[model samples]
Target chain A: MMRPTNTWFAEKLGDHGIYTQYMEDHHPAHMPCLEIRLLDWQQAAEIALRLEMRLVAVWATEGGCHDQPDSMFAYMGLAHPEHRHVLLRTQLGRERREIASISRHYIAACRMERHMQDMLGITVSDIPDGRRWIKHEHWPEDALPLRSEFAATTRMAQAEGSYPYVSSNSEAVCQIAVGPVHAGIIEPGHFRFLTVGEMILNMEERLGYVHKGIEKAMCGKTAAAGIRLAARISGDASVGHSWAFAHACEYAAGIRPPRRASYLRGILCERERMANHIGDIGAICNDAAFSFMHAQMQRLREDMARMHKQLFGHRLLMDTLIPGGVSIDLDQRGCRLLSEQTRMLAAEVEHLRTIYADHPSIQQRVIGSGIVSVNEARDIGLLGYVGRASGNYADERIEEAYPPYNELEVHVPQGRHGDVATRVWARFEEIADSARMIIRLLEQLPEGAVSNAWQAPEAGTSGFSAVESWRGEIACWLRFGDHGLIDRFFVRDPSVINWLGLELAVRDVPVPDFPLNNKSFNCSYSGNDL
Target chain B: MLKLLKQIIMTGDKSEPLPDSDAIELLGEQLHAHIRKHFAGSLAIRAVDAGSCNGCELEIHATGNCYYDLERFGCHFVASPRHADMLLVTGPVTRNMATAVKMTFAAMPQPAFVVAVGDCASGCGVFEPDHYAIAGAVNDIIPVHASIRGCPPEPADIIRGILQVIARRAA
Candidate 1:
C-alpha cells in the first residue's frame, strides 16, 4: 500500500529530476526504507525545501578508484515521515566546484556544508553564514584536510601557533576563551563566548583539536577490525556507533543478524541509553547546584554500569555487536539478572523523578531557560532529547523500527515547552521506556547462535544504516574495497545536528545559566570533531 | 525544607560499592606481572585509526577514567618521541589528518606496538578511503600490535591488546 504522503513526494520531486526508489512495502527487517537519489546538489536543495525533508546529515565522498579523477562526490540524507531517506549526490571537479548552499533552505545544512568546505574545499556559494565552521585560521587556506593528495608529513613541519579565532566586536562585549585544556578532565575543544555583562550575545565552538586522523588510518583494515573502531567513536555511545557500522556492513554484505543477536543488540542498546540518561539527568541537576541529586543520579548510573558489566562482561558493552551478529550471548542467568536490574532501575528512576519535580531551584533554572520552540527544533533538525523537548518525536528505533525494536513496545515521552526542564524530563521518560523495552525483549529472547563466522563481501558495493543512539539518530554509510577492506565510511553523530540548536537555544539567556543549559543538552564534542 | 525531606524519602540511599583496596592492589599486581611476563624487554606501541568520525576517544579516555582504571595496567597514551610504549591513535585518518599522523609516528620510540581500535582505525569502516581526505588503513601508517577492533574498541579490548603486546614481546 503506497502511503499518500510518499506518493505526493514522488510526484512533486520526480518532475524536478529527483529519482525516488520505493521500498515501503518491503519488510523493514530486510530493507529499512526506500531511498531517493538526486543527480546534483541544486536538485537536492530544491527537493529538500519543497518536500520539507529533514536534513538528517550531509557527508562528502572523495573519489578513490570509482570517482572520476579531480572530482569529489557529496551526499545528503534528507528524511521524512514513512521512514524514507532521500540521498542527494553532487559532483564537484577540482577547479569549478561551487554548489548552492542548502542552509538557506534547511538551517541544519549550514554547519554540514561548512564541514565539507573545511575538509574537502568545496565552496557552498551564497551560504548566508559561512565564517569557517570547522577549520580555524591555523591551517593554510589551500590545505584542505580531507583531500587525497594531502600528505600526512606536512603537519609536523608546519609552525605551531594559535589560530586566529574571529571575535565579534561590540561595545561592552568581552570574550571568554575556555579550554583545549580545561580545569577538569574533559575532551579537548575551545569555547569562545561573546558576552556583555553576563548576557551571551554569541558563542562559538572550536573543536577538532583531538582530531586523531581516524579517517586516514582506516584505509586498509578488514571488516571485523573496522567495527571495533566504530564502537570506540564515543565510549558512552559504543552500541549506537557499532550498530550504525554493523548495519551498514550487513547491508553491504546482504546478511541479516540472527533474531537472537538482534534482540541482544537491542538489550545492549537500551542499556547504553539508560546509563547515559541516568548520568545526564544527574549532571544537569548538579549544574543547577543540586549536589544531592548529582550524587544520587551518579549512583544510579554506576549501578546500571555494573549491570552492563555483569551481563556483557564489559561495562560499556563495546564490541558486543559485530557485523552479522553479536559477540556475546545472554544465558538464562544473565537474562534473569538483567530483568532484576531493569525493575530496580525503573523503580529508582520513578522515585528520583518525584524528587526532581519538587525541587524549586532546579525548576527555576530549567523551566523557561534556553528554549528551542517546536518550530525552531524542526527548522534546525534537532534530534534525541533536544527534539523531543520541543515535540518532534523522531526516534529511529520507534519511527523506523529495526530488529527487536519492531517487537518491543516503546513509549516516547514528548514535551511542548522545549526548555532545559523538558529535556531533562524527556530523558527521564526515555530511561523508563528503555528499561521496559529491555525486560520485554529479554522475555522473548530467541534461541540461536550469538554470532556467525565472519566472511568478506565482494568489493564496490555501498550500504546505509541508521540507529537511535543515546543522543539521537546516528546514520552510517559504508563502501568496501576490492580486497574486502572498507573503502569509504561516514558517520553522522547526533551532535552535528544538536550543536547548532545549542547555539540558538542558549542565545539571550544569562551566562550563569550556560553551564546548566549546556549540560542539559550534553552533546559530545568528540563525536562531532570528526 | 519540604523539598529536601521529599527528596530524602523519594531516593533511598543507593551507594555504589567501592572497589576493594586489596582487590584493586592484587589486580594491579597481577596485571603488572602479566605485562612483565608478556613484554619481557621493552614494549613500544603506535596508535592507528583507520577512520573514525571520533566517538572512540571516550573509551580510549575511559582507559584513564577514574573507574575501569587503566593506569594500574601501566598503559598510558604517550605524547612524543623517545618516551612511548604504544601507539594509541583513532580515526580512519582523513586526507587532512594524515600528516600529523606520520609526524606522531616518526616521533615515537622504536620497536613500537601499533594497536588499531574502532572501525575507522581497523578498516575504513564507515569512511570510504576514496574520500578526498582519507588515504588508507592503519597499516599505511605503521605495523600493528593487535587489532582490537570495534566501531571503537571497549576499554577492555584496549587493555587486552596491551596484554597481547606483552605476550608477543615475551615470545
Candidate 2:
C-alpha cells in the first residue's frame, strides 16, 4: 500500500534543524504544500528517504541575499501525491562549494547533481563516475555557465577531449556505438551497447548532444519570451512544457487565469497529449513491422493535424500559448467540427485497435520483450507511462489535478505486464480516454475572454509549477528578477527520468528489438538533452 | 481482402496527379524529365536534423503518406548519405551537433545536391545561428544549392524544393 500523506513524515522530521518557521501554503492551487528550509542536506535527505518521501526534482540555483552574496541554494522538489509538494531547501557556504551526494539514496538525483556540478561549479562530494556530464570541451576550463558572472557569449577553443565511455574487455562481450546521427529524421543522441552476440549485455547512453543552453539562454528574457524558449526545449511536447512555464509565471506573478482560460488550457493540454500518443502508437506498430497499422494510424493523425490547422491555425499547435492565457480562441463551429472529428477518430481507432490487439505479429514482436520488472520500476521510481506500465500507478493527473482537470474525472488506467506490449497498450487506453476529455471540453465550452493580464512578482521570490504532460510529470522552478525578467530557470522533463528506464529495459533484449523498445517508451532526446 | 479493395476504391487515390509534360519548361518539370531521362526518375534523399524542433520533420514525413506519396514521384528517403543524391538539412547547427552534420555531409557522394530546407538552415529562425551554443546554419557549415526558407515549409513546398534541387544539380 502506497501512503499518500506526508503528515506523519513531518513528525518524523521533528526538529532536525529544519525550522518550523513560517510557511507559504499554496492551498487553492495545489495541496497545503509547505516550503521549508533545511540546514543539513545529507541528514534531511536520509531521514526523508527513511520516511519514504519520493525525491522528485533536485534543482540548484546560484546567488543569494545581497548581504550574503556568496551563498548557493539547492532545492529538492519532493512529493507524496495525496499530501502535498514539499520543497526542501538547503544552502551551501561560499568557501566550500561541495555538497554530499544524495544520489546514493535516490538514483534519480545523479543527473541533477552532475548538472549542478557542470553548469554552476557546485561539486557533489564523492560517488563513482566523475566523467563530465554536461559541460563539454567547448566551454573554457573554468567557465561556470549558470552563475551571474559568466557572459552569455562565452565559447572556448574547439572541443578537445573524447568522451571516456566505460569499456569491458571480456572475451564474450563486444562493443557497438550508434548515433548522435541516426538513420531516422530524429534528434541526436549517442548509444553505446555492449553485446554478447545479438543479446545486449548492457546499454549506456551518452546524451546531452542537443544541449542548447536553454536555461542559460533564458538569463535576461521576459517571462513571455521565456515561455517561447521553454516550448522549444522539447518540440514534440511544446504545449506541455510551455504550459508548465506559463503556470509558474502566473503563480509567481500571483494572478489567476479565469475559469474559461483554465478550460482552454486543459483542452490544449489534452489535445497535445492525444497527438503525441497517437504518433507513438503508430510509430510502435511501424517498428513492429505492422506497416498497415502504422498507415492507418498515420492517416488518423493527419486528419487530426488538419483539424488542428483548421481550428487552431497550426498543424502542430506550436504557438498560441502565452504567459497569461491562450493566444487563440475557438467558436461554436470549431467546437462542432472538433466534436464530430473526435467521434470519427474514436470509432476508427477502436476498429483498428482490435485488429492490432488480436494480431499475431504485433503480439509476437512485443510480448515479454524489453521487460522492466515491478521491483526495478519501483527502485528506479519511474514516472508516467513507464511507471504505470510496471504497476507503479503514479498518475499526476489524478494526484496533482490543476484547475479544470480537478473538476473532470481523469481515468488513469494502470498496466501490469511491464513489457513493450504493455506500454503500447497503455498509450491506446490513454488515447481513448483523452478522446472523451476532448468531447467533454468542447461540449462544455466556457465563455469569457481567453487571455488575461497579469503583473510581475516581487524580485527574489521563486515559484514551482507542475503539469502532468502526455509523457509524464513536467515541472518548472522559476525565479523573477528586475523588470520581471527570468532570474533562474530549471525544468525537469519526464523524459529526463524515463531515459534511464530505457537503459535498464534494454539489458537482455536483442539488438533488433531496440527500436521497438525505444519507441514503446518514445522518450524525447531534445527534452532530455535540455 | 475484398473490403480492403473496396476501401481503396472509395478513397479513390486523393493525390492530385501532376502532369509529366516536357512542354512545360518550369525548373522542376525539366529536372523531373531530365532525371527520368538519366536515372529513370529515381531520387534518393537523405534528411539531416541539425537541431530542429521537429515541426519540419513532421511535415516531411506527411509527404510519405498516401495524400502526397512522394515515393510515387520517385523521391525516396535513404538511410545512408553515401546512397543519397540530395541532402535535405533542417535546423540551426548546434555546437555539439556541428561535427555530426559536417560528417554526414562529407560522407555523401560527390555532386550531392544540398537543399537547405526551412529558414533555420539559412540562419534566420527562432534558433539563431550566431548564438554561442549555435555554430551557424547548414550553409555556414557546408555548401548548399537551394535555400527553401519557411519556418517549417509545408509538404508541398518540400516536394517542390526537392525538385528544384534536382534541377539545380542537372544545370
Candidate 3:
C-alpha cells in the first residue's frame, strides 16, 4: 500500500495554492499533519472533497497556559488514500475564535461542528443547521465544558425551551414526539416525526440525553485511567474505543505492545463484533414482529456472552484492553473452548440465515422499507455494516490494517441496497466473517508477554489512532501534558455519521416501521452524545 | 412452516431455572405472597435509563432472554409507567435526563418501588459526583428503595436486586 507521505501533502496541497507547513511526525503512527492558515481551511475542504476523501472528525482545543496567551486551535481529521489519515490544523486568535463550516463539503461534519460549538464555545459560521448538538440549556450560556478554565464540578440549574425542530406548515401533517424516555429498555433519545396518517414526511432526531460529560471527565486523568472512561463511552463498543485510546497513548510514547497482546486484542475485538452482530440480527427481526427469530437469536447471543464471561471475566469485554495491550490471556483450554463455540455459531448462523431468507412475513416488512439511497449514504459517509449495506465500503480493518489485521485476511461484505433487509444480511455476513477471524487468531496465537510496562511521554506530545470497531471506525486523539496527565482528548464514534443515515432512511416510510429501521442501524446514543 | 416447527422442537424448552432459586424463594415467600396479593400474581416493571452507559440495560435485556426468562416468576417489563408496579432505573442521572427520570417516577402508581441498578445509579460509580453534566446518582434525583452495586451488575444480580425490592415491600 502506498501511504501519503508528509512531502506528498506539500506537493498535492501546494497545487491548490494552499500553503502548508508540515509538522514533525512525533507520533509513532505515520499520520501526516499539516498546519495551514485559517483562511485556507475551506479550500482544504474543497480539495479533500474533490479527492473523494471523507471528513473523519472535527474538534477544537484550547491551547493556552499561564505563560502563553490563550489561543484556540481547530482540527479536521480526513480519511486519505491507501489507509492513511491527514489532519489539518489552524490556530484561531482568542479575539475572533471562529471557523468557517466545512459541512458544505462533508455532510457528516454537520453534527460534529455543532458539537464543537456546544463544548468549546467555538462559533461555526455559515452552517446550514445552527441548532445546538449536545447542549440542552443545562448549563449557563457562557459555560463551555471543554474550555481550559471551565471547572468540571460546576453544577447548574436547567433552563426551559423546546429544541427548534424543523416543522412543516401543512395543516394535514401531524407531528408525533417520542422519547428521551422510550418505551423499550434502551438508551434515551428524542425522535420527532411529521406525518399524515401513516407515512412519515420528515424525521428529526435530537440525541445527547445520555451525555455524562465524558470528555470533560477525561481531562487530567492518567493514560491508564483514561482507558476505563473510554471503555464506558459506549458500553457495547468498549473494546474498540479503549483499544483506540490505548493505541493513541502508545503511539505518543513510542512503545509497541508485544505480538501476543496484539493477537489477543484482535481476537477480543472480533468476539465483541460477533456478540453485537448476533444481538442486532435478532433485534431487527424482533422489531419486525418476528418473535421466533428474536427469541432464538437472543438465546444464541446470550450463550456467546456467557462464553465471553467464562473466558475473559466480562460479558461485554469491558476493561479488557488497556493502555499497553490486553489485560487478559487465554490458555490452551480456553482456546479449545472458543474454537468449539465458534464452530457451533457458524453452523447455527447459517441455518438461521436460511430461515430468515425463506420467511415471507419478515421479507415483507424489511425488503423495501426505509431505504437510504446510495447517493445519500455516500454523502453522509456512513461506516461499518450500515455503510457496507449501502455500497459505501469503509471498514478500518481492511483499510488501515493496524497490528494483527495486517497479518490477517479480511473479507469485507458489500451490499448495493441500503434497506433494513440488506443491513440485517450485512450483520449476518459480518458475524460469520468475525467468527472466522477469531478462529484464525486463536490458531496462530503468538508467544510473548500480554502487556508491556508503560512509559510516560514528554509533555506536548500528541497522538492519534483509528480502529474498526464492530459498528464502524472509532478515531481517538489525545495529548500528554506535564506530569503525564492527559491535556486533551477527542473521540469520534461511527454512530455520529450512521445516525444521519437512519434519519435519511426513515423518510416516507410508515411510522410503525421506525423501530425496525432504528434497530437495523443501531446507532449508539452515548457514543454520539459524548 | 415445517422447518420452523422442526427447529422449535429441536431447540426444546430452553428456559432455565432461575439462578439461586431456592434462596430467592426462601426469602421471597414474601415476594410471591406480595405479587399474589397486591399485583394479582404478576409484577409489572418499567425500566428507565437515567443516563447510563447502557451496560446495565444490556444485562436487564438478558434477563428477558430465554435463559433467564424473567416472566416465569410473574414479573414482566411494561412499556408504560402507569402500568408498572416497579421502576427499574439505571445510571448517574445526568442534568439532561434528570427531569425525564423524575417525570417517569412521578407517573408510576402509588406503592411503586424503585430499584436503582448498577454502581453508577447507586452512588455515581466511576463518574465524579455533581460534575457539570451529572446531577448525581439515582437516589439524589429520586428516592431509591433498593440499589444494586457493580460497574454493571450481571443479569442474575439484577434479578436478585429486583427480588430484594419486592421482598421488602412484601414485608
Candidate 4:
C-alpha cells in the first residue's frame, strides 16, 4: 500500500485504482499528484467531480523519448476542496494520441482540450466543441508546434480556413459578427452574437487573434531568461504572470530567497491588483457613457503608475519579479512613499466609490445588465473578480495561502449579484482591500536581501505555482532541462476561464450593453489567446 | 448634481504639458495648420493592435486620458479605417492578423500615415528576431512613417510620435 497521506487525496482517491504520489520537488510543497494510466483519463475527471474539485488547466508536453515525434503526455491541473491543488498525468504513445473528453465532467476543460488538440495534435475524443482553437488557420493542419520534433523557426505560409461559428436557424433571430479588429483601443477577438432585436439569444467568442506562440518561443531558453517572455504573456498581468513563473522555477530548484523577497513580491502583486481594479472600474463606467468616473479614477491610477515607475523602474511593474526573488529592492524612502500613496489612494477611491454609488444615472445603466448567476459561475470555473461578484468566493491568496499572504489577513470582498454593477463594486472593494494590504506589508516588511543568485535545477525537474493575480488565479507549470534551460513551460491565465464567464453573462443582455459587461469582466484577450 | 459638480471642481484639472513642451508647441501649431490647410483641422486616427501583449495599448489608451488629452493636439481616435488619416499600429504583426492589417491599411484614404508604436511594432521585442508566429515588424507588414522606440513607450512619447508624423507631413 502507498504511504497514507494527510490530504483528502488518499481518502477520496484510494478506491479509484489510482495511486497518489507527492511531488517532492514541486514548489510551495503543497501539490499532491496522481499518475494514472492513459485508459483512466476520464476516470480521474469522475473522481475529481465526485470530490468537488474544479478543473484548472490542461496541456500536453513531450513524453518519454524527447527525440520521438509521436510521444507526448497530457496533464490536468485540478484545484481541490482541501485547499491544495492536484496534478493528474497520463503518458501516450504514437498509437494513442487521443483521450476521452473531460469537458463532459468539467465545462472549463472545453477550450483547453481544444487548445491541446490544436497545439500538439493530441485528439480529445468526445470534445463537444471540436472547432480549432488558438490556430486561426494560420498554420497548416499538420503542424503541431508544441511537439519537440517541430522546429520553432520553421515558418509556414498562412493557410485559409473558415471558422464554423455557431449560427441560429430561426427567422426571428439575426446574427451579428463583431471583430478581428474592433473599434476601441483593445486587443483583437471575434464575437458572434445571435440576437432577436436587441436581446442576445446566444453569444460566442472566437479568440486567438493575438497568439504569439509564447510557449514555442520559450523552448531551449534558460529559465531565468523566460521571465521576459512570461511578462509578455499578458502585458496587463505582467507582475502576476512573471511572479507565478518565477515561483514555479524557484520551487522546482528548491531554492528559497530571503523572507524579505516574499513580502516585496506581495507588495508588487497587490499594487498590480489595485492599479488594474481602479482602471477597470473607470473603464466599465466609461463603457456605460459615464465619463466622469473614468476621468477621476484614471487620474488616481495614473498617479499610482507614476509612483511605480519611481520605485520599481516600470510603470506597469513589468520585469520586477524574477526567480528566487525580486529585481528591485524597497528602501526606507520607497517605503515612506508607498505608505503615503496608499493612504491617499484609499481616501480618493472611497470618494469615487461614493460618487459612483450616488449617481442614479450610472446605477440605471449598470444595475440589472449582464447578470450571471452563482450556479453558472461555478459551472464555468470562473476565478478572480468575475467569480467573486457571482458569489464563488474562491481566492487562491486566502485558500491556497501562498506567502506572505499566509501571514497577512488577506480580505477577498465578494458581491452577491454577478452583474455589471456588482462586478464594478467588487473592483472598488478590492482596490480598498489591496490598498490596506499594501500598507500592512510595508509596515511589517522584513530586513534582508531582496534577491538570491539563481541556482539552476537539474534536468527533468518540474515545478508548479498557482498565484492569485489581480485578474484571477494564474497557474504556471515549468520543467527545467540541462544547464537550467526550460524544457517545457505552460501558463494558464485566468482569462481562459473568465472568458467563458463573459459568454455566459452576456446571454440575455442587449447588444449595446456587451461592451459594458465586457469591460466589467475585463478579461484579457492576449492572455487568453496565448 | 450639486455633489457631482462639487467633486469635479475640487478635483480640478490634472492635465500637464505634453512631453518636450517647446517642440510639441511648435509641432502642435504646425499640425493644426496642416490639418486646417488640408482637412479643416480634423485629424482622425485608427489604432490597430496586431499582436501586442497590450502594454503598448495601455499607453495608447493613456494618451486619450485627461493627463495626455491627445485630442488637444488635433488628432482623435476614430472607429473605422475609412475615416482615418493615420494608422497607429502596435505589436509585432502576427501571422494571423496580417490579412486584417493589410485590409485596414487598404481601406484608409490616400496618403495615410502609419506610425509603428513600440519596440515590438518597430521590431519584434522579446521573441526571437524571426520566430514562426511573428510576421516581421509593422514596417515589414505595412508602410511605417515613424516609429516610437520603447518596450512600451510612455504616453508622452506616443503623443510626441503622433505629432512628429503630422508635423513631418506638414513640412
lDDT of all predictions? 0.70, 0.77, 0.87, 0.86
Task: Give the top-scoring candidate (DockQ).
Answer: 3
TM-score of each: 0.77, 0.93, 0.98, 0.97
Ranking by DockQ: 3, 4, 2, 1
lDDT of 4 by residue, B64-84 (tens): 888888888778999999999
| Complex DockQ, candidate 2 | 0.52
Worst 10 residues of 4 chain B by lDDT: B127-136
Q: Which regions of candidate 4 are displaced past 4 Å?
A: A1-7, A21-28, A64-70
Cα displacement (angstroms), candidate 1, residue A395, comes to 1.4
Model 2: per-residue Cα lDDT over A326-435, one tens digit each:
88888889889988988788887887777777778788999999999887776667888888899777666787777778788998778878999899888888888888
Candidate 1 lDDT by residue in tens digits, A159-198: 3445556577667888888654332224445677888887
TM-scores for chain B, listed for all candidates: 0.70, 0.87, 0.94, 0.95
Stretches of candidate 3 off by over 4 Å are: A1-7, A64-68, A81-83, B25-30
Question: Candidates' DockQ values?
Answer: 0.10, 0.52, 0.86, 0.81
> What is candidate 3's lDDT per residue for A1-530, written digit by digit as tens?
23345455556789989998765533643576678999999889988888888889988887623114587889999886563677888888668889999999998898999988888888899888988878996555777889878899986655665678989888999999999899999999999999988999999999999899998899899988999999999998889999999989998887788889999999989988988898888888898888899888889989988998999999999999888888999999999999999879988989988998999999999998888878888888889999999988887787778889999999988898999989988999999898999999999999889999988787777888889999999999888888989888899999998999998999999999999999999999989997
lDDT tens readout by residue for model 3, B49-134: 98888899999999999988877777999999999989999988988898899999999998889999999999988788879889
lDDT value for model 1: 0.70
Model 2: runs farther than 4 Å from truth? A1-12, A15-17, A20-39, A64-67, B1-12, B16-31, B38-40
